[model samples]
Target chain A: MQIIIDPYSWLLGLAGGLLIGLSAALLLIGSGRIAGISGIAGNLLFERGPDRGWRALFVLGLILAPLIVGWLRPELRAAAPTVNAGMIVVAGLLVGFGTRLGSGCTSGHGICGISRLSPRSLLATATFMAAGFVTVYLIRHLPGLA
Target chain B: MKNLIGLLAGLLFGAGLTIGGMVQPQKVLGFLDLAGVWDPSLAFVMGGGLLVAFPAFALARRRDRPLFDLAFQIPTRNDIDKRLIVGAVLFGVGWGIAGYCPGPAIAALSALHPATLLFCVAMVAGMWLQRRLMR
Candidate 1:
C-alpha cells in the first residue's frame, strides 16, 4: 500500500488544533463552561437556563466565524456538500439525537471531557472512533453501497 | 463580560475547525476512510489539540473559580451506560456517512453550504424528538 503524506496538512492541522485547544481553554478559564457545541445549542432549544444568553452568542459566533474568514480570504471558503439530501438528513438526525443521548459531541466528549481526564469521555471516544471506522469501511468498500 | 468571552471562544473554535480542514466534508471523510487513501492529518490535529489542552486543563484544575465566573461547571458523571455507547455508535455512523460532526456542521452553515440548512433543521428536529421521547 502507498502512504501519502501532505506537509501542508500537518502544519495546518497542528495550528488549527492549537486554536481549538485555546478556545476550549478560554471557555473553561473565563466562564468555567465546557466548549460543548451540542450541549450549548441543544439546551438553548430544549431547556431554558441562565446560561442561555451566552450559549446563543457562542452559537451565533460559530455561524458567523466562517463568513468572516471567507471575507478576508476567499480562497479559504469551505468545500461544497455533495452528498444527496436524503443521506444528509439521515446523518444529521443521527448526530443530533445520538449526541443528546450520549450527553456530548466531539467537542464536548472528545476534546473537553478527555482533557478533563474523565473516564466516561475516554470510553465514549473509543466507542465512537471504532464505530466511525466500521461505518466508513462499510460505506466505502461494500459493493453497491457507495 | 462572560458572554463576550463565550463569543470569543466560539469564534476561535470556528476558526480552528475551518483551518483544520474539518469544515470540509471531503477531508473528514478521507480521514475516516482507513481502507482507502487514508488521510491521517486529523490525528495530528487531535494530537496538537491535546498537547495544549492538557496544560490548559491543569491550569483549570488549580483554580477554584474561573477568571470571570463564579464556579467551574464540569460534568462529574463517571458511569458509562448503555445509552452512552449506543448514542456514540449512532453519532459515529452519522459522522462517517456525512463527514459532519456537530461542531463543524454548525460552523459550515456560516458558509451557506447547500445541504447545511436541511441538515441543521433535521438535526434540531432530532434533538427535539430525543428530548420528548428519551425523558
Candidate 2:
C-alpha cells in the first residue's frame, strides 16, 4: 500500500494528455470519427462484421499497453487500489448510462468536444465536471459510502 | 496511415495514463476530495495537460484545414436540454462513487487494477442499456 512519489508522474501526465489530444486530433483529422469511448465501445459491441477491427484494436491497445509497460518497468507497478466487485459493477453501469444519455463520455466531450469549441461539448464537459465534483463530495462526506 | 497514427496516439495515451499515476483510483479520489486531505497533484497533472493542449488547439484553429485534412468536426448543439443535465448528473454520480471516469478507467487497465475490468464490463452494459432504452 505504499505510493511511490516520483517526478516522472507529472511528465507522464503531460505526455498522456498530449497523446490523448493528439490522438483525438488525428482521429478527427485522418478518419472522420470522434474519439469518444462510448461511441467506440458501442460500435465495437453492436456493430457487425469486419469494419470493427480497428475499434477492437484501439480497445486492445488500451488494455495491452499497460501490461507491456509494467513488464518493462517494475517500479511503475504500484499496489492496486481497493474496491469491491459489486461497487465496480454499479459504477460501470452508471458510467455507461451517463455516456449514452449524454451522447459521449469525457473523451468525446471533455477532450474532443472542448478542443473543437463545440458549445454542446463545452456544456457537456461542464456537466461532466460538475457531476464529478458532486460525486466526490457525496462519497467523501456521506456517512454510509466511505 | 490514419489508423496507424490513431493507434500510436492511443498507445501514447495509455502509457501516459500509466506513468501519470492516473491509473490509480486512489490518486483520483484524492484529487476529488477537496475538503479533506486532498492531493493537489492532479491539479498539476490537469494544468500540465492544458498547458500542452491549449496551445496545440489554438494552433490547430488557425489552420484552414487540419494537418491531415478537413476542418475540425465541432458539435453544433448548444441547448441546456434535459438529456444534457440528467446525463451529467448521472456521470458525476458514477465518478463520485468510483473515482474512475471513462478515459482514466480504460487507461487504468495498464496498472492492472481489477476494478477496471469490472468497470469496463459495466460501462459496456451501460452503453447497451442506453441503446435499448433511448433508441
Candidate 3:
C-alpha cells in the first residue's frame, strides 16, 4: 500500500497511451468501431459474417506490428515470456471468458468506454480495478496463498 | 477500405501497447501490486489515452456517421447487470494473476514465446467455451 518510488519511464508510458488513443480514434472515425480488442478477437473467432474480413485483418495487423518494429529495433520488442505455463493458461482462460461475458476488456471498458464517460464503463473499470488490487494483495501479501 | 482502416488501427494500437510497456507482465504486476512498490506508469498510460480519446470521441459524437461506415457502430446497452460485474471481476483477477490482458497478450505474440502462444490458444479456447456455456 505504501508508495515506493517508481523507476519506470512515465514519458514512455504517456507516449504509448497517446498512440493507443489515436488508434481508437482512427477506428472510430474511419470504421465506426470501438477498437475493443477482446470483442474484435472474439468475434473474429466465432463470427462468419461480413464482418470477419476486417476483423481478421485487424488481428493480423496487431500480430505483425511488433514483428515489424522488432525488425527495426530489436530492443523495443517484448522481453522473453517469464510467467509459468500453468499461470498463463489459467489467466488466459479467465481473461477470454471474462471479457466475453463482460462484453469488453481493458481497452474496451478502460480506454474507449471511460473516455466516453459511460456510467457502465466507469463502474466496470472501478470494479475490475478493485478486483485486481485485491487479487494482487492476496497473491503478494498472503504468504502461501499464491 | 474498412479492412485497411482496421489494419492501420490495429497496428497503431499494438504499437502503442508495446511502446507503453503494457506488454511486460512484471511491469503490469507492479502496477497492480498496490501493497508493494507501485509503479504508476500504467496510470500515465491511461491518462494519456484519455487525453486524446476524450476529444476524439467527442468529435465522433458530433458526427452523423463515420467516414467509411454508414453508422457509428457502438454499444447501446446501458443497464448495469450481474454479468458485467462478475465478468470484470474475473478478468481483473486473471490479469492480476498473470499480468496479461487481452491486448498486451495478443500484441506480445510477436515475441514468439511458447508461453505467449499457449496463452493465446487458451484465451481463444476460453472465448469459445464461454459461448458454448451460454448457448
Cα error, residue B64 of model 1, in Å, equals 0.8
Q: What are the Cα lDDT values of the candidates?
A: 0.85, 0.68, 0.87
How many residue-pair clashes does candidate 1 contain? Answer: 0
With candidate 2 superimposed using the best TM-score fit, by how many Å does residue A72's alpha carbon deviate from the native?
A: 3.5
Name the better of 2 and 3 by DockQ: 3
**TM-score, cand. 2 vs. native:** 0.83
Model 2 error, position B69 (Å): 6.9
- lDDT of model 2, residue B90: 84
The TM-score measured for candidate 3 stands at: 0.95
- Candidate 2 clashing pairs, residues 3+ apart or interchain: A66-B110, A131-B92, A135-B96
lDDT of 2 by residue, A1-146 (tens): 22335556656666656666666655655554567767677777888965376677677666666667767876554334366788778888888898879878777777766766777778887887777776777766879966
Show where candidate 3 strays beyond 4 Å.
Answer: A1-8
Candidate 1: segments with Cα more than 4 A from true spot? none
Of models 1 and 3, which has the larger TM-score?
Answer: 1
In model 1, how large is the Cα lDDT of residue A77?
64
Q: How many residue pairs clash in each candidate?
A: 0, 3, 1
- Best by lDDT, which number? 3
Query: lDDT tens digits, residues A74-104, model 3?
Result: 6668653466788888888998998998889
lDDT of 2 at A48: 91
**A12-64 per-residue lDDT for model 1 (tens digits):** 88887898898888998999989988898898887876898888888888877
DockQ of each candidate's interface versus the true one?
0.78, 0.46, 0.78
**Candidate 3 C-alpha lDDT tens digits along B94-129:** 888888889988998888888888888988988999
